[model samples]
Every structure is written in structure tokens, then in C-alpha cells.
Target: MPFLDRLQHWAALRPDANAVTIGAERLSYAELVDRASVRARELAGESSGGPTVLCRPNGLAFIVDFVAAVARTGTVAVLDPGWPALQRSAVERMLQGAGPSTPPAAAPADLRDGPSDSIFLYGFTSGTTALPKAFTRSRDSWQRAFATSAAWFELGADDRVLAPGPLSASLTLYALAETLSAGAAFHTLERVDVGDALDAVAHAGVTRIVAVPTVLRLLGERGLTSGVDAHALTGIVSAGARLDGATLASVRNWAPGATVFDYYGAAELSFVSARRLRPGEHRTGSPTAVGRPFPGVEVRVLDDAGRASAPGTTGTIFVRSRLVSAGYAWGDDGSAFARTGEWCTVGDRGHLDVAGELHVEGRLADMIVTSGSNVYPQEVEVTLLSGLGGAAAQVVVTGLADARRGTLLVAAVVEESGPDAPAVTRADLRTAAADLAAPKRPRGYYRITELPLTGAGKLSRRLLAAWITEGDPRVHRLD
Candidate 1:
């Protein structure tokens, strides 16, 4: 059941099949196998054989390097592509926890994080405050996670998978797995350009695409993904965050023939719940209806009593699956989260449907209690995106301290216009958020040309929290 074994198998079966594509570089199955084997041999005696770091730029070399490390060392640590040089240098220093054996052979460090963080994949996940909760995924956990996602997506040999999102993000790992496991062709924009992705699909005759909601938003904004011209594609598997109805409409319109499936998962939990939306059906950005337990996955929704909740009642989501994490690279955080029988969750809150669909509400930690009402920040943000002037694709809602309620919501947005552009205003945001409670409306607006995004390309709410907490002059982009 080893993951990379599939690549070796597929390469043997279909050595001539197109395995991966970058802008000017294409690697067939045989070529990929040959190259990765060579790269792995180059690292045979350099490190602990536990983890190697991947800090290279995106392209043929980066992908080959990561796969090679995973094949030989059984672990790969991925660094952010967008990390500033100084911060990257600091982070690299922190992640150098892996040490080579005595009489180390010649090799540059596989990937550098720093001295104490030899994790295969370690990054910070968003929380309510300015700090990102440290999260790590092991090689074993990632293989299981990718398998779970591939099963839900129903990957096949005929599928041509496109990861329009950042190739570095584990989300794109879904496509990489299919490339090897099922011998599907993997295509992605090396630089994450919008039209380039769509054109890649068309150019490659791609059938299936895996994209996060943000990339889908870009396609909508640029008219590249509307349904009117939907032809070569079969459908898209959406993850990372919930996809709302308005955005789904644009996705469907852009690729009319494609079925846009919604998946509810976190990097920790892997791919837990999913459902394929029929053409006539609607997806309202609710994470809840993500379908029932995946194959071999047992799910439970526990109320405060620790008892299973009614089908429609929301509670913390717990999953027992082959794909669950073995543990973190650092701490014992999974004790309360994972019990006997391999059950664990990333602290998502949602309820089970009568048909057994799993709908995610929000993270339990991000739930805001204002006037004793349990308010989900994501719900309020979705409402604002649908109703408010902040419908721009780059807005992210986060929680901050409030004198009255202890915690309040804040909005951070990106504009094509400069940060001083008058398109977004705190009052306009308030008016658009009127459907939500006064306590839930974002109290401030901060504008940046781009959201402080992680190397994985997820919005860095921790960074946004800092901006909101500082009450920086840039927070008043109201003008």
C-alpha cells in the first residue's frame, strides 16, 4: 500500500504515457521514473532518510526533486515559494532538524526549514488570533490523505488532471497521485496564472481539474471558466475552502459540461467528505453537505455530551480512516482529537445529513460567541461575499479582540486598484453584512494589493489578524 510504489508500477505499465507537464518541460512516465531514481540515489547517504526539504522554485526540477526524496527518504518537507528571502532563511534554519549519518556523502540539504523542524510537511494553519497554529504532516499521513482524496475523486487512467492551484500546495498532490496511481496526465500552470490554466486545460485536452475556491474565483472574474464554452473538461473537484452558489454558478457557466464537486477537508484530516453536484442542483457555499463517510472512513458528530448528535445536529467531526494522520512532527495535540480505532479530526464543526452527507460549519476554534450566540466566521464571510461590496475574490474574514464581545470579525481584502482605492469601505461592508447580526459584521476593513498568503497559497489569517490588531492606518481603506 506504499504510495510511490504506484508510480513505479504505472511507469512499468505505461512508460510512454505523459506523466507531468510544465511550460516547456514534459516528462513521460519512463522519464519521470528514471530521473527520480537517479535523484533518490544521489541522496542515499546524505540525511536521516526520514525527511528532505524542498525549497526550490516551481518547475520540472522541483517536482522531480520532491518525488525523488519521497521515493528514497520516505519524507519530504515543502517550503513556501513566496516566502521572503530573510523569512525563508530563518524558517529554513528552524526546519533543519534532520541530520545526516556519520560519514555523510556529498549533497546539499534536501529542504531547509531550520534546526529543530525536520518535518515532511510543516506549515501554520489559521486561528482566531495573530498566530498560526503550528501543523505538521508526516510522509505516511500524506500518502494516506492523497489516497483518500483520489478515491473520492474517482480518478481513472483516461483522466487528464489539472491542478490550477499552486503546485506546491498539498491540494495539488491530488493530481500528482492520479498521475502516478492511475497514469493520468498531470497539468498545472508553473506560475499559477489564470488564463494560462484554462488554456492548459484546453491545450492538454484535460478532462478533470482540481482547483481551490480562490482559483475558481479568478476564473469567474476573468470569464475564463464560464459554462457557455465548457467542452473538453469533465468536471472540477473543489477543496481548500467551501465553494458558494454564486461562485459555483460562474464555475458551471464557464465549463457548462463539467460537474463541480465540493470536498470538505483539512490538511490534517485529509479528504474526509465529498459530493458531486448535479448540473441542476446548487451549492450554497455550505461545507455541511460534503456527502457521507468516504469508503472505509467512519465518521461521527459528537455533541458536548460526547455522544453522537442527531443527523441534523452539528458537532465536532471525528473520522476514523486509513488516511488519518499518524501524528504531528512536534507535539501530542492529537490525544483528545484521536482516540483508539484511528479516529481524528482537525476540529471541524458540522452535522451529518439524512442521506449521510457531511456538512462542515466551521472550525470549532474559529467559532465566535457574540451575545452568547455561536457564530461561525466563515458563514458571516460567505454572507458578506454574496451580499456586500467585498465580493472581490481576494477577501478573507478573520476574528479579532472586541471590547464588547471578547472577539469580533474583521475583513481583509485585495484590490486590483491600489490599496487606497475607494471601491471597498468599512461602512459598505457593514451595509452588505446587515443580514448578519451587528456583532458579526466586520468592524474594520483593511486593504492590501494581495492577501498575506502562505507559500501553499492559502490566505494567511494569522498575518491578517496582525494587521487588524494593529489597527494600522491601512485598515481604513474606506477612502
Candidate 2:
């Protein structure tokens, strides 16, 4: 069943149960349905059943508006609330111009029986230009993903999920939808606050947390020091960026009862692969391993010629699955996201090991060519985060212009802080990266107070590069 199709069932089965919670505000399943129905009627009366723009901050209202828009129009565009005024206006203009010109028939009274193949979501991905690229997904794709991810993670009606990030982010939005579809309670913060997130896990009976690695790290550290009880947390789902070994260790220590899972996915491709680390189980394999393909998904590593690459041979990663989005709605510059027959690739380069585990190197656009050798920054960043043994809280690798080597590989690290945090130095980082090829190693190291992140909370390599190029005072060079 589609996501909204299950809402009525949940409302009937658990009318008084909390369906969505943000901060202190909450709506029961029945209340959620009623509010959404009211909003759906309001939406139908306001505009034609065309695309609707949702640019609100994380809150119960955003959730209600999203469901209402989806039920009424079946097409909703989510924009970051933190976007600059100019960018927001530009995106709104683009969405307005791109929507259907003719008005569709009146919305149905039920509002929950839209066709499965109808496009329900329009998500934007960070782009090279001033405006982000918009991508659309059919209701069927998300319905399949909701089922697959819920089953994979063992989410059920008894679970209370906390996704403490902006709902505008795809990861958090999907978490809310997946939890609601499973007839479970969903919790989030109006603004990302570690104290509030810890309180939710401690006092709200939150059974699962779905967030990016950065938020997870903050919550883990704060929860540990504040003595917040996380025994109710059964699962920790990390995505949007790679989860470093230190953060994973801290999260395990903080939430000893929960299993930590790190998944690799993109906005265009719903879910590619995931790996789970059971409580008390230490990761013992390749740092880049992202586990097997998700159920109903086929992964292929294709060389430049489009033929499947040999095992352990790095190539462009492609996916064949029903979860793939219906391509871009607009802002397609052709720099990423392409298809060959039934296989789709976003130019992410990776390889499959002998055991069929996928290891993502990095995106082709982020590859650095230094001294005639190609280097993927993700591999180097992973090496620093995992190989350094809790020495760095975060790591970002980028390339700077050079005279001799085409590009100079550099690294910016946020050193682990606190009484027990390990002491590290430039020499230690170099020694730890000995396993990497000489060309792949970072030639320069810099220290920063914190990792630069985008509006969505994912680490922004573009911003880090800009910082280095502009000689930002926040970034301090290390000898």
C-alpha cells in the first residue's frame, strides 16, 4: 500500500497513539488524519491540484502540510527552510513555472487513494549552479522503499522513532514517512538541539533514531556526558554521509542496546546498500564496505566502456531497481545522474569485493588528480577517521591547485576533544595513512574547530574547499 493508504488503518488501529511529535507538540493518529483532511480541503480550495511548495521548518505543521499536499495534489516540493531569501525565491519561481498549466480535476474526498504511480515528491539536490536540481519520485517507489527499509530494520507499530533533523532533508523526511507507514510514532526537533534529542531518547520511549552521522555524534557525546538513558533505543540508522569509526564507537558506547546501521544512498536512488553493527560487535572489515545491495535492488560497477568491472576494480556504480526516481523535474545540467538502458548511475565510483560487498570510493566529480594519480577523497577521509583510532572527530579531504602536480591533495581535520579524547598530530596522521598509496595520501594537513556542513547537515566538501581557497580564519594549518 502507498504511504497515505496506511494512515487510515493506523488511525483506526491506534487512534490515541502519538503519530508525530516535534518538541513538545504532538498529534495522535486520529488527530493527524483529521488535521490532514482539513488541510487537504484547504489546499484543494486554494489552488489547482498542481505542484505545491513546502518550505517550512521542522515541526508538526510541516508534517501535516506535507501529508495534506500529497493527498490533495500528489506533488510536493520540499525546500530547505534555511535557504537564503534569493535562493528560496528563485526556487519558488522555478517550481511555479514548471508546474502544470491546466488545472486538473477536483481532488477526491478520500484523498488517500491516489494512483500508486503518481509522482508524490519533488526533492532538490545540491547543484553546481545557484539553484539546486529537482528530482521527482513516484508514490510506488517510496511505498516499496518504506516496506523494504521497515522490514530490513525491523520497525513495527511498537517503535517510537526519533529523527532529529529538518524534515526538508530527504533522510529525515523518509524516516518520518517510514515510521508513520509502519504505524509507529515519529519524533523530531523543531531545531536540532542535542539536549532536546537526548531528552527525547531518555524520556519519550524512543525506540529508534534515524539521523546523519553528525547529529548522531553530537547526541552520543552529549547523552553520554549527561547520563541520558538510551536503553529504549533499539536501532541507530545513519545516512547522508559516511559514518566514521569514532562516531560509531561513541554511538555504541552511548546507546549500548541499539544496533548501529550505516547505509549508502542518494536522493535520486532511494536505498543502495546498508551494513549493520550489532551491539558489542566491532567492525572488522574494509572501512569503505557499505554491505550488500538492498532487497529488490541490483548493483553493478561498470567501467568506462559500460561493461561490468571485475571484482575489486573501481568503476562507476550503477543501480537497477524500482526505487530509482523518475529523473529530474528540472535543473538537469548533465553533470550527474544518467541512465544506460535500465541501469542508472549518478557517477558514484565504487567496487564490489569478492564477497559482493560494495565499497564506495567517491563521486567522480570529487575525484582529485594529483601527481598523475587519481585519488578519491572518501577513501582518504575514511582512512583518517578509521585508521587514526578516535584521533579525529571529522575529516574532509580536498584538492588545491598546484604548480607541479595538477592538484595538491590536502586534508582538514577536527581533532577529537575532551578529557579522554586521543591526542594526535600531523606525523601520527601520516603514519596512520601509510597503507594508502603515496599519491593518495594528503600532502598538507589543516585543523578546524568543526566540520563545515551544508544546510542539510551533510559535510560540504565544496564549502571546505572554498574555506581553504579563501584562507578562512577558522581553518588553521598544521605542520
Candidate 3:
């Protein structure tokens, strides 16, 4: 059965159980099913070929509508509610003439006959480009993801999941579905507020947190000051980006009793490699080591010839699993996902250790070949962040076209905040980056007021690359 059917089953099993909560509002399993049924009836009434665009902010309304659309087999496309008006308008214009018509009535038969292979979601990839790529997911793909996450994360009915990011983000959206499918209460904020999240954990008995590392770091910092009972948090899952050792240790210090997990995955490829951050597990191998493959998922580090590379050799990372998406929908960029026989790649460059642990270098397009050596910006950034201690606030390493070296490795630093913010110089950064090999260490350094960030709070390397190539007023040369 699909996710909604699983939810209905849970509703039948636990009608009065709390299904979802957002601040003061709470929905029991019965109420959730009823609301979704009403919404599904409305959606079923609609003409169903085209996708259903869910552009609303995160709340009970979005959840109900999403579930209803899924149940009615209307391909649900989630849009970032915080998208710029111009971008939103452009997408709206492109979709205006192609949307489905209204149906006469909600058909109950439509719900029962929907096949697992049928497309249910229109997920957009988070990119820095002008337009995002839309990808389709069959019910089975997400259903498989639900199972894998439940098993790997060891989720249960007793767990109360707190997903603090926007629901438009696939990580949080999958967390919502996974929480419901596991018959657990799902909690989220309409917008992420660290104070509100802490309150929920302290007062509302939120047991698990599914969030990006950046949000986790903020929560950890607050938890240190505010004093949250670590025992209240059962598990914390960090996704969307890699967590540096310092951030991981801070979160561990705050939630010592909770099992902290960080997974490396993309929207197109669901759950990939995941690792637990215990005390001694911090410095395992490479900073990029993201742990072993998820349950029932197979990964390969293949060279240009499409053969598996030797362990520790970087290559194109290919995934073969039912959890992969049904491929791109509208904007099949042709660069992201490529198929070779049975396996497919999402353009990520990574490798497997001799022990079979996956270590991600960076995105294939993001790799920088400078001074006759290939440098992964993530490796350089990780080294700088770790070596600099608290000196480096935020660091982005991007390659700029250079006349001498072909590509110049530049490190942009957002120095620590405050009147006593350490006056870091290019010399200091060069000395701090000594931990990295000669080739990987950044040659140029710039102290900036702010690091360019995506709307989703991720480091916008593309924007930084642009700012480096074409001068930006925000940047200051640290010569």
C-alpha cells in the first residue's frame, strides 16, 4: 500500500492517537484521516492528469492537502513558499496554461485502484540555477524509503518526530511521511524557530528531530544555554548537508543521550549513506566519510569507463535501488541523473573505502582542478573549518579562472561575529589550512561580512563562485 493507505490503516488501528501537531493545533489519527478524506474527495473531483501544486507554507493545511492529493493520485508538486516573487511568477506562468481542470465529484474508486508504479509526487531539486528541475516519484519509491528509514532509524509509535524545516524541502517532507507511516506523531513549525523547537522538545515531549546540520547546531547552542533534558530526545537525524566535527560534537554535548545520525542524500536519491556520531567515531577516515549504504540500497563508485573503481579512488557515485526517483519530470537537465544499464547517478563524486564506507568528495560539477591537482571544495572547507577552530565562522572554497593555474583556489571566510571577532588574515587562513595537502589548501583568502546562503540555509557555492569571478561589494580582499 501507498503512504496514505498506511496512514488510514494506522487511523483504524489508533483513531484517537495524536497524528500531527503544529504549536497549539493537534490532529488525532481519526481527525487527520477525516480531514484528508474531505480534501481527497475535493481533489478526486478535480481532473487528474496534470500535477497539483502545493505552494502553501508548512502547517496542518499543507499536510492534509498533500495527503489528500497523494490519495487521489494527483501528482503533488511542492513549491518553496519562500521563493522570490519573480521566480514564483515565472514558474506560475509556465504552468498556467497546462494545469488540470476541475472534476465534477470526488471518486472513491480512484483511491482504491491507484497502482504503486503510478507517479504521486513532482519533487523539485534544490539548485542555485534560475530554474529547478522537477522529478517524479512513484508511490513505491517513497513507500520503500519509508520502510528503509523506519528500519534504519528504528522508529516506533512511541516516537514524536520534530521536523523543523520547510515542508517544501524533501528531507522534511520525507520525515513527515515517515513519521506518519510509522504511526508516530509528527510535529513541525510553520517556520523554523529555534526557541519554538526547544519549547516543543521541553514541553511537548518531542522525542526525535529531523533537521539540517545548521538548524541542529543552533538547537545545540540554545540547548547548552537553556538546559534541555537530553533524555527527552530519543534520536536526532541530520540531513541536507554534512556536519563538521565541531557542530557534531556540540550537538552530541547537548543531546548526549540521544543517538545522533547524519546521512548524506539528495532529493533525487532518497536515503544514501548514514553514520552515527559517537565519541570516538568523529575522526574515522576522510572528513567526507558519510557511513555505509542504507538498508536495501546498493551504491557504486564507478570510473569513466563505468567499472567500479578501487577502494579509496574517487569516481562517479551510482545508486541502484527501488528508492531512486522515476527520473526528472519537466526539466530533465540531462546532467544530474544518468542511467547505465541498471544503475543511475545523481552527478555526485564519491568513493567507497576498503570497508565499503561511502565518502563523498563533492558534486562532479563543483570539483576544482587547480595547479595540475583536482581539489574537492568540500574537503578544503572541512579542513579549514576543523583547523581554524572558532576562528572561521563560515567558509566557502570556490575556484576562479586564473591565467597561471587555470583555476585559482579561493577561500571566502565569514569571520566570527562580535567586537572581539578574531581579525583573521590571509596569512592566518593559510596557516590554518596547513592541515590540508599542498594542492587542496586555498591560495587566496577573502574576509567577507556574510557568506552567500541559499534560501534553504545551505552555503551557496555557485553564488560565491560568481562573486569571486565578478567582483562583489560585500567581499573584502584579505591580502
User: lDDT scores for all predictions?
Assistant: 0.65, 0.84, 0.79
Give candidate 3's root-mean-square deviation (CA, Å): 3.3
lDDT of candidate 1 over 7-118, digit per residue (tens): 7677778889989887768899879877766676676566643346676656888877766665423456566566556656655555565433222222322221222222
Alpha-carbon runs more than 4 Å astray in model 3: 46-49, 89-113, 277-283, 368-374, 399-408, 414-423, 434-443, 448-451, 463-477
Better of 1 and 2 by TM-score: 2
- Ten residues in a row with the worst lDDT in model 2? 100-109
TM-score of 2: 0.93
List of clashing residue pairs for candidate 3: 45-103, 46-103
TM-score, candidate number 1: 0.79
Summed backbone clashes in each candidate are 27, 0, 2
Instruction: Mark the regions of model 2 whose C-alpha exceeds 4 Å error after superposition.
Output: 100-109, 127-129, 370-373, 386-389, 401-407, 420-423, 433-435, 470-473
Name the candidate, 1 or 3, with the larger lDDT value.
3
The number of the candidate with the highest lDDT is 2
TM-score of each: 0.79, 0.93, 0.89
